[model samples]
Target: MLTNDRIVLKILKNNKRRPLSAYDILDKFLRIKRIQPATVYRSLKNLLEQNLVHRINQSNKYIVSSENSHENDVTTIVVCEKCNDYEEINVNKFKMSLAYNILDLKNFDLNDFSVEISSQCKNCKT
Candidate 1:
């Protein structure tokens, strides 16, 4: 991994709850050394390609990929809409087979599957 990629991974590992935007990473990493947005983005792309990180499409932020997440397992991201906090869960293969079964019933070819559920956290609910 590149120095910038390691820096970004460290940031993501430290930040386990809320996701961080590319600019957020750039800002944090900049305190250590000067870097640009494109650099941060490139690091992110590398991390993503390596499956070391996951992107929250809803918020355009990134988080460390769960160690439990595998290539075939489904990654379900539950985000608290109010607080913007998030959690990643790796659904077991049994659940994945069920999904495949459903899709097969429809004659849909399964490739990659991801799910994002939006809800309010306990604190936000009150």
Candidate 2:
């Protein structure tokens, strides 16, 4: 891994349970190194392209990809609105079913996909 990769990875690893925006990561890194916003964004872009990180569109944040997940795998992210935590779930069977349904439409090309579900976490419910 490169220097920027290492630094960004460290920040993400430290906050693995929650998704963070680029600015959030940059703020945490500023105390340690004289880093810039572009540097953090570049590192995040690199990590995202490499599939080492996953972007949560709903929250506009990023999280470390799960250990068992691959770039091609179907991923479902469940986000807690109350706690701002997220978890990744594999839905391979559902993916296959959805793909078949889409294929039956007979003109739609299935490329890439991800699902994000938002709800209050268990702790927050209590």
Badly placed stretches (over 4 Å) of model 2 are: 93-100, 104-108
What's the TM-score of each model vs. the native? Answer: 0.84, 0.84
lDDT of 2 by residue, 1-126 (tens): 349877888889889988889889999989788877899999999988787888999889989888898556777889998888888887674566576586676666656667788998888899
Which RMSD values do the candidates have, in order?
2.4, 2.5
* Model 1 residue 56 distance off true place after TM-score fit, in angstroms: 0.7
Model 1 TM-score is 0.84
Q: After superposition, how far is residue 84 of candidate 2 from its true place, in Å?
A: 1.0
Q: How much is the lDDT of residue 44 in candidate 1?
A: 95
lDDT: worst 10-residue window of model 2: 91-100
